[model samples]
Structures are given as C-alpha cells and as structure tokens.
Target: MTELRISQKEFDLFRDFIYKEVGISLSDKKIGLVQSRLSKRLKALGLSSYDDYYYYIQDHKEEEIFHLISAISTNVTSFFREEPQWAYLRENINTIFASTRKIRIWSAACSSGEEPYSIAIFLKENLDHYKEYDIKILATDISKKVLEKAISGRYVAKDIAGLPKHILQRYFDIDKRDPQAPYAIKEDLKAQITFRMFNLVYDDFSIFKNRFDFIFCRNVMIYFDGSSQMKLVSNFHKILSENGLLFIGHSESLTRNNKEFKTVRPSIYERI
Candidate 1:
C-alpha cells in the first residue's frame, strides 16, 4: 500500500468545505496538515485517496459533517484547566448568584463535561441557597462521542488530579481497584448537568426561550475564521441577559468583534 499523498486539489476542497461549514480557516501551505489530520479516518475506512474519503462524507450528511468537525476541531480541555477563571467565579458567585434566583448557565462547546461539572461543584460549595434556586447547567458540544462520555461523567485519575480531595470524594464514587474504569461522578453531580449534541456553525438559537446568566464558550473559536467569530459573538450577545457574563478562552477576544460586551478582565466579559 502506498503512503497517502493528499493532493493539492483534495486539500483545497476540504479546506474550503470546512471553512464554509464551520468557519475554520486553512492556508494553502497546509497541504501536509490535511494528510496528518484526516489520515487516520482514511486508514480506518481503507480508502486510498483523500478524495474518496471526502466524497463518502459528502454523500452522508449527519455522519460526514460530524466526522468533519471531529477531524478539524481541537478538544483539549481539563477540569479547571485555567484555575484563575474559577477563582473569579469563587470571588463573584455571591454577587452573580444574588442577582438571579433562576441560574441558567451554558457551557458551549463543553468537551467531555469536566468544565461544567467543575462549575456545578463550585456552585454547590459557595451557594448555600442553591437548593432553593432553579439551577440547571446546559452543556453542549459538537462531538456526539465526547458528549456521551460526558454524560457518563466518568474520568481517569489524571483528569481528576486537580480536583479538590473533598469534592472528589463527595461527588465521585471510587473505582475500587479498577484503574481502567476510573471514578464516576455521583448521581447528584450528573443530575445537575444536561448534555446535548450541538453544531455551533448553523444551528438556530430561537429554541432557547430564556436568556442565560452566564455563558462559558471557551477554547473552541480558534478553529473559526473572523466572520464566524463575529457571528457567534453576536449570537452570544443576543442570548445573554443584560449584565450577564461571558467567559471565553484567555487567548480569545470579543473586543474587536462585538461592542455589546466590555471586558471586565482577561477571559471574562460582562454584558453592557
């Protein structure tokens, strides 16, 4: 079998298709980029050419599109990966929770549920009145596979290393001797979050009837082009209530894209 040589034409087709579908941008020089990323799927499917694999995806809508997203997007996150943002939440939860009795928060592009679960634990600790409030966490991701794993709320020991010992013990069941299985999140923590499969590129937001208090859309925008970023920011602006906070990845910015939000600090924005 010949090593896969992703031709220039095939690369261009995929690059344009991904950008149009999900706002990702790939430069012309990224010829080997396509080969390296999509090579696994090609090998698995026993397809000789990138063109053949691309056509297979094109013929099948749901499966193909999702595979495209999985191939193109990066899902590198961990429990409280950026600790300072959680610290901000710790300092401000009282004020934020005080203003709203109904806490509706969204972890957009939430990869594998760790971030939202972390948020849930944070709320449980700080908000003594949490039981009284109508609180729900909506965690959505583009990858169906990751969403299922998230719904299971199971993680290896490494993923839970940063977690506080008490919260880990309280919120998770020990795996006994099975290192392979890891600890599973307790029913209460799992109950606090709801997982859904979502495609951020072209989905309608009208179904979300109520405005959210906080929207944590972090680390996913690095894939999108400038126009898609602007559109997503606009959508976020429309969905968040006045004075609602939007938390983005530390490397991302809404300052240039949307005027409705003013950056309070790094990675955190307040709706103006």
Candidate 2:
C-alpha cells in the first residue's frame, strides 16, 4: 500500500470546506495532521487521492460529511476531565436544584459517553432522594461514531480506571464475559441519558423547544474561530434557563465585550 499525499491546493480546499461546514479553523500546521487522519478514510473508501475523497464528500454530503468530520475531529474525553467544575457543582448542588425537581442538562459536544455518564453518576450520588427528581440528560456530538459507542454504554478497564470502587460497584455491571468491555453502565443510569448526533456550528438551534438548566460545551469551542465562538456562545445564552450555568473548557473564555453572560467562575458563565 502506498502512502497518499494531500497537495497544498487539496489541503486548502479541505480547510475551507471544514471551516464552512463545521466551524473548525484549521491552521497551516494542521495540513500534516489532516493528511494523516483523513488518509485512513480514503483507504477505507478505496479512493486514491485526497481530491477524490473531497469531491466524493460533496456528492455524498449527508453521510460522508459525518465521516469527514469524524476523521478530522479529535474526540479526547474522560469520565471527569475537569475537577473544578465538578467541585463547584458539589458545593452548589442544593442551590442548583432548589427551584425545581425537573432537571434538563445538555452535554453539548459530549465526546464518547464519559461526560454524560459522569453527570448521571454525580447527580445520583449527590442528590438526596434522587428517584424523586425528573432528570433528562441530552448528550450530543458531531460524530456518529462516538454516539454509537455512547449508546452502547460499555467501557474497557482503562476507560473506567479513575472511577472509585463504590461508584463502579453501584452504577456499573462488571462483565467478566467480555474482557474488551469489562464495564457496562447500568440500565437505570443509561435510561436518564439520550445520545444524538449534533453539529454545533451547522445545526438548527430552533429545534430545541425547552431551555436547559446546565449546558456543558466544554473544550469544544477551541476548534472554532472567534466569530463562530461568539455565535455559539450567544446561541447557548438564548437556549439557557434564566439562571442557567454554562461550562466551557478551561482553556477557553468569553470575550470581555460580550454581555450575554457573566463569569460565575473560571470558565463557567451564568446567563445574564
């Protein structure tokens, strides 16, 4: 098998296409990264060149666009990637749940199942009389590939390695039969979440009829350019409940000029 190379023209075409379609700003340095990542897709499709794959995606936009985004997007996530946010949640659990027993949370850009599952676990552990409250967690991502895994609710040992023993025993079923995916999320916890495919940049936000109490768009906006980020933040503000909290990636922040939200904590914003 010969290594496929992407020309500068091909790279530029993909760069513009990806940004237009998904709001991901690819830097010049990402040419090598894009080439290496997308080459696997070309091989799978039996396409010989990056140009062929590019046009193929145009013709087959509905299905292949997901594949294109999946190929280029990095889905690095864990059960509890950020500790400060969780600690804050723990401290303010009562205040957050005071108004209503009904809780709506959107784990936007939820890579794999870890973040949503963690939310479920956290709520179950922290909330007294957990069964009395109505909890619905919407976990969505741009990649169908990750959604499939999330729906399965299965994980290998290393995937759940950071979880405490009691949490594992309480929420996960130890599957000795399947060594590959030794831990399976219990049906009760899995029932609380709904996984779907969503493109934050391109999708229609009008589809959401209900506002959310919490929106976790963590670590995802770094890929978008400034304008796209601002647009996304504004959309989040519009869809959030009156006192809703927005949690973003530690490395990301809202611009000072923006007035839709006020900084509640580091990387956390409250709807204003």
Candidate 3:
C-alpha cells in the first residue's frame, strides 16, 4: 500500500519533475490537486511513497511519461466545443477551402478525437467535392492512451451530446452489436485522420516536412509558462503557410510583443 499524504518535500520534487518533463508549471495552490491526482498513480504502482514513484519514473522515463500526463492534465473536450470558432470557420469557408483544396490540419493535443473528428465532419458538410479533395488531419497528443481511443474512433453516445442531430446521423454509426461502444465514428471518417502520440513539449516538430493550412492548438497552452508558450506559438508561425489559420482557446492569447502571426478573429491567427 502507498501513502496518501504528500509531504512538502515530495510535493516540490514531483512539481518540478512535472514541469521539466511535461512543461506544466504547477502553482503553490495546485499542491493539493497534484497530491490528489498522483495518489491514484502511486497506489497503482504499489510504490511506498511519492519519492519512490519519482525515482521509478526517472528510471522508466520512456514508459511512464504518458501515465504522468494522463493523471494530471485536463483533456476535457467535445465535438464543436467553443461554438464561436466553428461559426467563424464556417463564415470564412470560401477563403479557407480556396486556400488549398488539398487541406492539411493538425489538431494538436486532440484529447480523445472529438476536435479532429469535428474537423472531418465539418469539411464533409461544407465542401462539395470533399471526397475528391486530399483532406488529412494529423491529430496528436502526448498521451498514448487517448491516441488509442482516438484511433479506435469509439465514443459513448453522451460523448457527442453537443453535436447536431444531422451530424450524428451523417457521420456516426451506432454499434448495437458491441457492448462497449454505443456509437462509433464511420471507418471512412476515421480514415481521414491520422492519430499519433506526440509530445509537443518534448518531441521534435521538424519531421513534419509539410506546411499545414490550419493548426487547431486550442486550450492546451494554459499549462505552459510564457516562454514555453512563445516557443510553441513561434513554431506554429514557422510551420503555418501564408494565409493559414491558427486557432487557440478563447481564454488564451498570443499577447507577447511583435508576434509574427496576424490576428484574424478572437483566438484565431493567420500567417499573412
């Protein structure tokens, strides 16, 4: 059995470890949250204490990093989340689809597949020859667990409560045969996306030799400090094509001086 309480020394050790490994800076106020979140991990590993788990993680860094992020990071997302952004995208559909009939979008930190799947559905609904267009969505997250689920394209019916009824009818096929998944994304829609385990903080972005038309990196940067945020936004600016769009969370902003990307709308930036 493992200890439930996190000592101050243990808290500080794990806090810094998380920041260094995952780039998520935990505040003094989050000490309790950290303790609570990691307790489950501690019990699962059968470690004697937080310190033991920390050392275990260091030794098994490759395998344990995903579990660490899964325990603490907030991955709450759904289809068509933040309604304004979708409205804006649809309003500018002509300019967007015109940029390249062959569209490439990256749903960076796509939690469980809703955002990328939403992108797939939106394109199908809007584009007249979407089937002919070379549409590909690169959906990546640090957590392999979520990526597995995303690749499976399975969700409970409640996972899609926010989606429109027509969209539900058009894109999803209910699986009465399976006990686990009440609804599953159609195989063709799942094929439109390529999900992979990618660490935005730790992994190399240079492998992506191609520029993307749209990069939806929404709501995840709140965990990053300013310097980290600047580095990521600058990378986004570098990889995005001229006139390409970068959509961030409504609460987040690229407020740092002389940012290269031009602001198009709330939480939307363009590399113009």
Q: Give me the candidate number with maximum lDDT.
A: 2
lDDT of 2 by residue, 1-272 (tens): 65688999999999999998888999999999999999999999999999999999999999998888888888989998899999999999878887689999999999889999999999998987788899999999988888988999999988998889999999999977898788999999999999998889989999999999999999899999888898899999999999899999999999998889999999999999
lDDT string, candidate 3, 160-187, tens digits: 7877778888898977677788789998
What are the C-alpha RMSDs, in order, of all predicted structures?
A: 1.8, 1.4, 1.8
- Order the numbered candidates by TM-score, best leading: 2, 3, 1
Q: Report the error of model 1 at residue 115, Å.
A: 1.2
Residue-level error in angstroms, candidate 3, position 87: 0.3
Query: Each model's C-alpha lDDT?
Result: 0.83, 0.92, 0.86
Off by over 4 Å in 2: none
Candidate 2 clashing pairs, residues 3+ apart or interchain:
none
Query: Which of candidates 2 and 3 is the stronger one according to lDDT?
Result: 2
Best of the two (1, 2) by lDDT: 2
